[model samples]
Target: MHQYQFSLVFFTVLTQWALGSILMISLYRAATGGQELNNSKLTAIALWLICGFGSLCSLAHLGNPLQGYYALRGLGSSWMSREVIVFGGINGLTTLWLLTHLVKGKENLQQTLGLITGVCGLAAITMTGQIYYAVEHQPSWHTPLTHIGFVSTALLLGLATLALVLRQSSKEMPAGFRALLTASVVMVFAVTWQLAQITGLELNGVLVWYRVFASLMVGCGLLVMAKSLNLHSTAMVGLAVLLMVSGEIAGRMGFYGSVLGKMPW
Candidate 1:
């Protein structure tokens, strides 16, 4: 379905924030504590590439790139301003950390940076959700639960995708890959539970979209578990990737479609 341009733009902004935040933390987790996670660096590198490209595209959508420098002016009054700040800071910090890891060949410092990236990345998406959550006039967007929903969707999708991509490169993987799969599936369930609670509140179209999206997310998790149980890690990971895409896309659509007029403003 067609969406208003700005609405599409806003959705993209939040997506970029969510994906970047999830991956940063995951990479750091792989590398830290001397885990010696094969393909962890590759995941980190992919995080930098995909998320960075999305960010650039986001920036390009801006009409006045230089004016973006003044974006934080509304921090006191605008959630968007806060989003810009978190996005800018975490992106910059993550880049430096990722680069340092590459050139310096890893260190405790990189792990520290990873921690920072994860926290900031999650915050950035939280800020994105708040960008709407603060709109007290919009009931659908006004709930604090929206924040949880946004973050959960991001984590589930990001982790599942990263897990899927990594498993593709090699047959063997960290012992935690299965655990990670479990955690991601749990996240999907959490999101689905929340969506059901919000059902019938959104427009019929939006509600239908959310149900479909939410179901697919849940199913993806189940599929992963099934494959994993059958000792089919490769298939499970591949399906997880598909599941993540469905969940993220459906979530963004649900969010946009749920939007309605301001409360008599």
Candidate 2:
């Protein structure tokens, strides 16, 4: 149970990184496709840091940490195997990213590594959640769309935290702000839908936290937008931060509370 709690925290953080990676690729893809954004470097970096660190924490949960390397040998048969491989790649690339930045971004080696890292980072996050989705026992966990919910929340929290970090960068982010808030709202709705699917699964404490956090997330997003529109950026920031924390707590509780058939709590 304690391990599950730790894993859930790691999973949440990893998923956020995955969301940031997806967003980064999407933005880059869009720009190449003639679409545009008011890109925020600070926001992007913070997301990378938190998500990357979160993914690395999984190493703590490995029962036989040394043998963890051999897990990737099974990728041919399972996504979990690929996740192990990808998480390693994410760490390696993050090391490269740091080195590249230290060298004033002139390292082509780092540049290439960054691209691979970005892809694997998202893959790690997606597959982390997908691990449960692959389980055929727990119907709540077996939902095909659960992976999307995990990915969406990652984007929401990643962007929100990034926005906070960007405030210190002193950069104007009109388009970035709009896009992130919109995504945040969408994430809240998606969470609601997923919870709806699990209405009365005999998981009371877990569902209670899930619904509470889902509602908190949505309510907070709305409040932030409403306040921000009324010339209250401070109020919006406060609301957003509160919602993000509440959402995280809710998510962790739900993850820890729910019992899988493979591992009864």
Top candidate when judged by lDDT against the true structure: 1
lDDT of 1 by residue, 1-265 (tens): 3432344444453455445444534563555453444555665676666566656655665679778778778878887777777767877876776775577655566666766677677777777778777777666668776777667666655555555554555434355655665665565566555654664444435544544554354545454555557755667665655555555655565565556422234
Backbone clashes in model 2:
0
Residue pair clashes in candidate 1: none
Model 2 steric clash pairs: none
The local distance difference test score of each candidate is 0.59, 0.56
Q: Report the C-alpha lDDT of model 2 over 66-119, residue by residue, as the tens digit.
A: 787777778777877877776666666665655654465454443355456656
RMSD of each candidate relative to the true structure: 4.3, 5.0
Top model by TM-score, which number?
Answer: 1
For each candidate in turn, the TM-score is: 0.73, 0.69
